[model samples]
Target: MRSPAAANPAPHLHLAELNSFPPPRSCLPFLVRRAETALRRRAHCHSSSRRSTQNQLHSLQIPGRISHGNPPPPPTRRVILLLLLVVVLGAMGNSIYKFLCGVCSDLSDAAFQPHGAHASVAALGRDILEFQRTKQVPEGLSRHVVSSPAAQANWYKKLQVAWKKARPAPTTPEEAGRLVVLTLKNHQKADVDGLLAFYGLPHPNEAGSAPPPAAGHHAPPAQHSAPAHKPQGVKFELHTLPVDAKAVADGDTVTVYVDTNDAPSEIKKAAAERTKARAARNYPTADALQKTIAAAGYRMVPNAKGVEVLAKKYRIRLSGIDAPESAMPYGKEATEALLKLVEGKCLTVHVYNTDRYGRSVGDLHVGGVFVQEQMLKKGFAWHYTAYDKRPELAKWQSQAQAARKGLWAASKPQEPWEYRKAKRNGNA
Candidate 1:
C-alpha cells in the first residue's frame, strides 16, 4: 500500500543510495576541477594536432627543403657559396692574427733589450742568419749567436752607427771590449783546419788539400842537429823554459852578456840555413826557435815567425833576434843564438813593446848570457838603433868591425836589402 508519489520502490532505492553516499558539496569542487582540467587538456591536444598538421603540410610544400641526417641535398648551391665565404673570412682572420702577433712580438723584443743593444738587433739577426746559412748549421740550433772578441768589437762598432741613427744611450769602451772579448773566446779554434774553417781564415793546409802519397812513398829524412860549438869563457848553464811548468820556477834571476862584436860567420850561416830549413818544413816560422825556448824551460807562443814568452808571471822577448819572417838583416842569426842560449834553462824575460814588425821586443837572459849582444858581437845583426838607441850598441859595432865578426868580415858589408837588389839585378 504505497501512495502514487512513492508507487515505485526504485525511486526509494535511489534515495536510499543517495542517502548512503557522502555529501555532494565535498565532491563538487574536485569534480568541477577535474572536468575543467580534462576539457583544457583535450582542447590543447586537438589544437596541437591541427597546428602540427598545418606545419607538416607547409614544410612539405616548400621547395628544396633540406635536413641534416640525409645526404643533405648536395649542400645547397647557396650554402656552398656561403661556406666558401666563411672559409675566406676565416683565412683572412688567421692571417691578420699572425701579423698582429708578429708585430707584438717584435715590439716586446725591442722594449726589453738593453737600451743601445736593440739598435743593431736587426743587423745582428742578419749576420747570425748569414753565418748559420753559410756554416750549414742544423735546424735545431739555438737562435742565439756566439761571439768572439774580434766579432764583438766589430758588433760594437756597428752599434755605434746604429746608436747614432736610433738615438741609443752611450756606453763605455771598456764595456764594449768586455762584451766583444766574451764573444770571441766562445769560438775556440782548437785545431788548425777547424780554426781556419770557422773564422774563414786561411792556412797552409787549405792551400794544398791534396791526398797523401801512396804507401811506401819516400819521405825526406829528418834533419840532424848541428854539432855544438864550445866557445871560450862561455859558461853554459842549462835550465828549463819558464813556459813549461817543469822548467825553472818563475821570477828566477838570470844574468846576460852582450858581446855582439865576437859572433862568427859560421854561426850566422848556420842560423840562416836553419831558418830556411824550418820554412821548408811547414813549421810555424815563429816557432823555429821553439825547441830552444822549450829547452830553456819556458813555453813559447809563436807570433809572426818569432817567439814570445807565454808564462803567466814573466813575459820575456828574445833580444837581438828576429825570426826569418819578422825583419830583415841578422834576424835569423840573432834568433838562432837566442834559441841556443835559452834551451834547457828557466831564464827571465824582460818584456818590451811591439817592434816595428809587431814583435814583442825584449831582452832574453839565459845562464848569464846577453843573447842580443851575442848576435851583435857575432856580426850577425846590426843594432836596431832606430828602435833602440842604446849607445853601447854603437861601441859594440865598432868593436865588431875591428874584430871582423861574421858579416863584419866584408870589406864593404851591404845591407840585406841592398844585397838582395844586387842579386836580383845580377839574375835579371
Candidate 2:
C-alpha cells in the first residue's frame, strides 16, 4: 500500500510542480532547450518543403512525367520535335515535283515549219555555187537531204547527175538569161520575168528591143543611116575571116570566141579612143553622117550559134551600160533598140570583167559596129557612169539629152535605180 501511494504521490507531485505559479530561474535553461528543439523541428519541416518544390521544378524541366500530378501524357518536347520533323519532310517532298514538267514542252516545237518553193530554187543555186567553190555541201542545202545515210548518199548522187546535165558557163548575156529560164523550166514552171527579176537579171522584155517580134513575124529591113562624115582619126580594119557568134546577152553584150587566126586586136582600143573623141563633139556633122551612111554597106552578118543571134545558155552583162527595167518607163523602147542592133547578127565580144551576178561584163560588136555606142546613140540606155568612167559615154548621154531621145523625151524621167528603190519601198 505505501509503494502504490508513493508512486501515485510522485505523479501528483509532478503535476503540482507543473501547476506551480512560476518555475525557478534555473528551469529557464530547460525552457530554452525546448524552444530550440521546437525551432529545429520547424527548420526541418521547411527544408522538406523546399526539397519537394525542387523535385517538382526538376520534373517540369525534364519534359516527361510530372512526379506530383498525373504523369504528363507524353513529353511535350518529344511531340513538338516529331511535329517539326514531319513539317520539314513535307516541305522537302514538294520541291522535287516542279522541275520535271518543264523539259517535255520544248521538244515539241522544233519538228514542223513550211519551207517555200521559190526559196528552195534559190537555195539550190547558192548550194551549187558553194559546192563548186568549196567542194562541200552547204549546211543550208543539207536540210533537204534525207536523214538516213543511204538516202543521203542517193540524193547526192542524183544532185551530181543534175549538175552534169546542166549547161556549161554561159558565153553571152542572152545565153545566161536563157540558162536560168531553162533550168527553172526543167525543174518547175515559174514566171520568166519574175524569175529574171529574182535572179537580178534584166527581164527578157527589158533586155532587148522587142520580144523577138513574136514567134513567126518577119523583121523589118535594117535602117542603115549613119553620121555624115568619117571620123578623121578612126581607122576601120575588117576581119575577113568570120567567127561564130556564141551568144548575145543584152543590148550591148555578146559572147564570141575567135575560131580563125583573127585574134582580138588592139584596133578595138584605138577605135574606142577615137570614138570617145567623136562622142565629145556631141552631134556629128551632116557630112560625117553622109559618109557613115555610105560606109554602112560594109555591115556583114557573121556565122553565129544562137537563134536570132541571141544566146540560149550563156550569161553576159553589157559592160558600161544599164538598160531600163521592164517596169520602168521607156524600158520597152530600150530593149527594142538593143534587139534591133544584135538580133540575127554575129558579134565580136570583148570580155572585160565578171559581175556580182556571175555574168561576164563585156563590150559587144555586131558586124564591126560598136553595140553600146549604137545603144547610146539610139537613146535606149544610160551609160551607167558609176561603172563606166569614160568621158565619151558622158558626152553621148549629153547629146541624147539635147536631142530628147528615148527616156530623155520625158520632162522628168526617173532613173532605173530610183525606180527600183521606189518599188522596194512599196511606193511605186
Candidate 3:
C-alpha cells in the first residue's frame, strides 16, 4: 500500500504549483483543477473527522449543533455593540431619504397642507355668507333699511297700518310727501319712529303734546294753500280698492273691488305709452323698468294715467296730466313731457268727486304751478269734454292751435276725437 503522504500527493502538488506558478501562460485551467481536487479532499477529510467527533460528543452527551434543547449563548458586549451600530446606520439612511423627498416638493403648494388655513379666514368666510343671506329679499318688499330686515319690515308694516288708520286714503304726491315729511320731521327715540317718518306719518307727540301754533308760525300746508286758494269740492283721502272684487276681510286689511270700469280708455293707453317712452329714452328697453314696476307690485287701471295701485287697498293717481285721457298719436311724447316736469319731484292734487268713468277729477299742481293748466298751455293735452269743462278750454285750444303745439303740430291738425274715428275706420 502506498504511504499516507503519497495518497495525499495531490495536496502537496497543489501547494507546489501555487508557490511556483507564473502569471497565466495558459496554465490557469490546470492549476485550478489541481486546487479544486485538493480542496475536495480536504473537505472529505474534515467531514469524516467531524462525523467521528460528533459521535464521540454524542456518547459523552457534550452539546455541539444548535437545537431548542441546547442553543448557543448570546454574544458578548462587544459583538452586541457592533450589531446595534449597524441597525442605527440603517435607520439614519432611511430618515435621510424621507427628508430629501419632503424638500423636493413644491413650496407654492404648502398652503394645501392639512392644517394650513388660519382660523380668522374661516370666521370671515362665515360672516360674508351671512351678510349675503341678509341682503336677499322677495319682490315688492320695501324696507326702512335702518337696521335688520325683520326689524325694518316690521316697522314699515306697523307704520303703514297706523297711516291707514289715521288717514282714510292717499292722494297727491304732495299730500303723501307731507305725510312722509311730517313723520320724518318728528323726532322719536326708536328706529321705527324714523321709518314712520319715511312714510310721512305725524308723530303722536305732534298730535297730542306739541305746543300750539303761536302768532303767525303756522304749520306749512302739504296741499293747497289752507283751502283759501284751493278749488271748491276737491279733497284728498286714502283710497283702498282691490283689483279683485271679492275677498274676505281679516284684521285691519280688507279687500274690496277696484272700480275701473268707468275709467277712461285713453288714460290707460297713455300710461302704457308713457312707460314705453320712458324706457326708450332712459334705457335700452322697458324690460328693466317693467321688471322694477312688477317687482314693486304696481298695477294699472282704467281711466287712470300712471296709476300704481295695491288693488283697491291703495291707488295712486298721478297728480298731473302728461298726456290726454286717451292715448293720442303723441301720447308718448306728452307722457315724456309730464315725466320730465314731475319726475323725482313733489306735486299736489286737488281731487274732485269720482267722474262717471270712476276717475278722480283733479287739478294738479307742481311747484305752485297748475300742472293741468301748464300742460294745456304747452299744448300737450286737450281739455276732455266730459272731464275738463274749465272756462279756459276754448281759449287754451285757440292758443294751442295758434302755437302749433301737441297734436296741432300736424300739417292738418286733426282733433283727438276725429283721429280716433279715422283710426277706427282704418283711414288715419
Candidate 4:
C-alpha cells in the first residue's frame, strides 16, 4: 500500500503545492466565499430537481412531465383553482372600484388639482393642465401620451407661446379665456369654459372687448376699438338642429331638421295635417300635404336617432370651408368626419345668410366644438378664402399645409373650388 501510494504521489498534490499555493490573506475570504457559493449552488440545484420531481406526483403524466431541460410543475388542478380565485377576486375588486367611482369622487382626488388660475404663466399653466386632465381635453388623449413628463412640458410650452403671443399680460378672466380659446383650437367650448369657470374666469362676451382691470389695479388707458361686425347680411341663429348621416348630402353640405313648432305657422299646419293623414292611412292626402310642406323649405324626415319627426328641413352649406366633391380626393373623408361629429347631436347654428345655391351658410357648433375649425385644421376642406376672410381660418389652413395633413398630403393638392371650376371648364 505504501509503495503504490508513494508511486502515485496523488496527482492533485502537485496542483495544490506546485501550481497553486495558499491564497494571499487579502483574497482568502473572497476565495472561500466563491468556493462555498459554488458548492451550495450545486447542492441547491440537485435538491430543486428532486423537489420538483416530487411535486409533480399528482400532476398529469404529459402536462406535468419533466424533460431534460424542463422541470415538472405542481398539480394543474391546484394551479387552475388558484388562478380562478385570483381572477374572481380581481374582478370583484374592479367592480367595487367602478361602482364607488361612479357614485362619488374621493376627497383626495382634488388634492392634486390647482385651486384657480393665479394670474401667472406657471399658475395658469398648472390650472389648465389640471382642467385638461380632469375634463380629458382634446377629446381623447391616451394614457401613454398623458403619463409622460412631456405632457406637462408640452402644455407649459403652449401656454408660454400663447402668453407671449398675447402681447400685454392678461390681468382679467375674459382675456385669459380668449387666449385659451385661441391656443386650444379644435377643443370643445364646454370643456374650455368649464376650465375657465373653474379658474374664476368668465367667458368672453365679445372677443374684441377689453377685460376689466383686476381688483385694486388702476384702469389702463382705454384703447378705442370698435366692436367687430360680420359682413354677413342679417345674421340669425338656429337654436338647435338635429343632423344625421343621411342628412350629410356632401362634404360641404348637411341637411338639418328643426321641429315643426319652430317653422312658419302655415308649414306647421301642413306638417300637423300630414301626420294625421298618415295616421289615418290617407296616402294621397298625406302626399299632397307633404308637397305643401316641402314648398316652404321644410320636410318631415327621421332624425339621426331614427325617430320620424315633422321637422323643417334646411340645406346647410358649411361656411368658410369648401370641401371636395364626392368624386374628388378626400371628399368622402370630409363628409364622414362631419357626419360622425354632428350626427345624433343637436347643433347650434349661427346662420350668416343663405348662399346663392339656396343653402343656408353658417357656422356649425356641437357640444362646443367648432365644426369649420375642425374641418380646416384637419385639412378636410379649404378655407374658402374667396367667400370667408377670417384670419383664424387662414392660420388653421397654413398649419395644416405646413404639417402636410389630410388633403395637404398630396404633392399638388387642388383647391376644392378650383377643382370644381376645372371640371366646369372641362380642363380635367
Candidate 5:
C-alpha cells in the first residue's frame, strides 16, 4: 500500500507519516502574494470598459488650462477652416442686408428716407387730390407743383393709381385728407392746406373736423343739424317742410314743402318782396308777389304754433300707388286718411325720379311709417304696378282683398286708373 517516491529518495524512512506534515513556511508567503496580484489585475481590467474610459478622460479636463490630456488635437484643420467660413458668411450676409435696406430707402417713395423728403417736405394735400381727380394741369403750378407738365402728369398718374388701389374710396374730410397726404409725398405745409381747402377736405390745421363753407355759400339750416357729408354709396337725403292741415291733397298726392333756405335765388327774392309788401300794407302788390312766390313753389305757411314761415313747396305723388280720385268713391275718405297720418308731421322724401306730370315721385317716410305702405294696406290705393313693382305692395293688396277691407268691400272694385280712364273717355 506504500506510494512510489522520487528516484533519489532521501530516506525520511516513514512515507506514510508525510501525509500528516505541512509544506515549507517560505512557500506560503509567496503563494499569498501571487493570489493578491491576480485579484488586482481582474478589478483593474473590469473597470477599463468604454464608459469607464470616457469617465476617466472626462475627470482629467480643466477650464482655461491643460491639466492632463493634449488640448483636443488643436481643433482639426477642417474644423478650423469651417469656423472661419461661417464667420465670413455671417459678415457677408449682414453687409448684403444693409445694402438692400439702403436701396429700398432710396428708391421707395413711401419709405422714410433722406431723399427729396429729407431736404424740405411741404403740404400738397388737396391740390394732390384735385390733380388726381381732374388731371388738368393747372397753370402756374408748373413751378410749385412739379418741374413740368410731364412731371406733373407722372405725379398725377402715381396718385391716381394709389387712389384706386385704396379700397372703398375715402368718405369724410379727414379720411380724404389723410389719403391725399399719404399718396402725394414731400409737399409743403401751407400748400397742402390750400390744396385740401380747394377740394373741401379737412385741413391738417383744423385737426380733424370739416372745413367751413365756400364763399357766398350759406350753411344748411341747423334744425336738421344734418351731416354735411352723406353716407357712402347712398342717395342724398331731402327733407320736406312741416305738413300743415291743408298739405294733404289725397291718398296719393301730398302738397309738401321745403325750406326757403334751399330755394332758388329768384324764388327767394320774390319771397322777400312779398314779405316786405305785406309789411308795407300794399295788399295788391303783396298779393301779386305772393302769387309769383307760390308759382315758384315758395310759400308762407303756418306751423303747428300758427307762425307763418317761408318754405319751398313741392307736389309729391306717393310713389307706386294711384288712389281713388277725389270725385270717386272712397275719395274723401282717402284724403282724410292721409291727412290723419301726415298732419303736423315733417316728412322725409327719398326722391328717386320725377314723373312726366312734373311731380317728384318719391317714397315718403313719416318717422318709421311708410306712407305708401299705409295707403296700400288700408285698401285706399291700388298698387300701380305699371309704374312701380314693389312686392310688399302686391302682398298687402292681396291681404286687404282677402279681408274685404277698404275698397275691397265692393263685389268688384274699380282701380283708380280705370276710373280715371272711364271718366276721361266719358264712359263712367
Candidate 6:
C-alpha cells in the first residue's frame, strides 16, 4: 500500500492545488480593469498613428521629405490644410480676374475706335487745313493715312524731301500753291486736267478752237466774227466754242471737256455732243466711263455755302456766293438746300479765275437755271461782292435781304469771312 499510494499522492496533490486558488478576486472587476487598460493602450496607439499620418502630410507639403518624428496635433493640421486650400483658391481667382480684364479692354478699344481708312482721310483734311493756316507743313501728315506706321513715316519723309527740293521752300501763298500743285502732280499721279480744274487754272485746251492753223495750214473761214458779247446784264452766256460737261464739282463749279464737238446750233446740244465725243475718246465704253468716274479724286463735299470738289489730291471751292460756315446757325440748312438743287443735275461751268487757296472760282448752270442766282434768290447764300461785282447778283441779294432769308433771318448775321477770322483768333 505505501509504495503504490506514494506515487499516486503526487498526482492527487497537483489536482487539489489546481482546484483551490480562491476564486481569483471577483472576475467582473478584474475584467473591467483589463478592459480599461486595453482601451488606454489602444488610445495611445491611435494617437501615435494620427501623429505619424500628420507628419507624413506635413512632409508632403514641405517640398521633398518623409518625417519619422511626431507632427503637429490634429487641430493644427486641419488649420494648415484649410489655409492652403484658401490660398490656392485665391491665386486661381486672381489669375481669372486679370484675364477677364484684358479681354474687356480689347473689346472696348475695338468698339469705340474708327476704322483706319476713315481716320486717315479725316487726318489728311485736318493736316491740309493746318498747313494752310500756319504756312508750315506738319511732320506727320501721313501718319494715319496708311495702315502701317512705318509706311506712313516713309511716305511722310518722302513728301517732305520732295517739298524741300521743289524750288527752295515756299515763301508766299502763290509759291505754296505752286509747291502743292507740283507735289500733287508728282507724288499723287493726278490727271493734269483734273488738277487744273481743282486749282481754277485755265485748261490749256479750254478754248477748244481748232489748233491755230498749224503753222501755214489754211484755216476754215471764221464762224461769223465771233458772236458779239450780249449786253452786260445777261443772266448767263454760252461760249460758241464747243465744250463738254465733264463733272459737277460743286454748286458753282463744274469740269468741262477741253475740246470741241460737231453739233448743230443750240449751246446745250453742242455741249452734249462734245461731252459724248470726249467720253468716246477718253472712256470709250460705259464701263470705262464708270471706272474713270470711280477713279476720280475729286468727290463732292457738302459745305455750308455750296460744295467742294475734293479731288484725289486737291480741293475746289465754288464761286459767286458765300454761305455761313458749318459752326454757324442755318449753315447746315444752306448746305442741304444746295445739295437738293444740284446733287444729281448735269451742269455747265464757266471758269473765271483761281483763288489764293487754289480753288476754282466758276459759275455753274443747269440748262437755263443759274445756280448762284438761284441760291441767292432762295436766301441760302450771300453775294460775294469782293470778287463778284455783277449787278444782277447784288439785286438778288437785296431781294433775299428784303425777305429776311436764311442767314438774313438772324438779327445781325455774320459774314463767312469774318466768322472764319473770329474762329482763327479763338474769339468765336
For model 5, what is the C-alpha lDDT against the true structure? 0.60
Q: Which stretches in model 2 have alpha-carbon errors above 4 Å?
A: 1-313
Write model 1 residue lDDT over 299-389, tens digit each, in one string: 3332211243232223343443322222444444545544444433334345545445443445644322445665666776666554566
TM-score per prediction, in order, is 0.25, 0.31, 0.29, 0.47, 0.44, 0.32
lDDT of 5 by residue, 64-87 (tens): 352345555555876998999999
Q: Considering lDDT, which of the candidate structures 1 and 3 is the better prediction for this target?
A: 3
Per-residue CA lDDT of model 2 for 145-185, tens digit only, reads: 21333433343344433434444423333443455444433
lDDT of 4 at 84: 99
Q: What is the lDDT of residue 95 in candidate 2?
A: 56
Ranking according to lDDT, highest score first: 4, 5, 2, 6, 3, 1
Poorly placed runs, candidate 3 (over 4 Å): 1-227, 235-328, 421-428
The prediction achieving the highest TM-score against the true structure is 4
Question: On residues 1-428, what C-alpha lDDT tens digit does candidate 4 reach at each position?
Answer: 43321332322332123214565656655544444344345446667444433332222122223223655456997799899999999999988997664422232323223245234323455544455456333333322121234443454456545554444545544456567656654433333433443343434434223333334432211111111243355377664445655988777788887765667778778877988999999999999998998887788876433556767778888888999888888988988877766765566677888878888998876543567887888889899989889899999999999999989999998887788788889986
Q: Each prediction's Cα lDDT score? A: 0.39, 0.46, 0.43, 0.60, 0.60, 0.45
- Greater-TM-score candidate between 1 and 4: 4
Task: Indicate the residue-level lDDT of 195 in model 4.
Answer: 40
Query: What is candidate 1's TM-score against the reference?
Result: 0.25
Report the candidate with higher TM-score, 4 versus 6.
4
Clashes of 2: 23
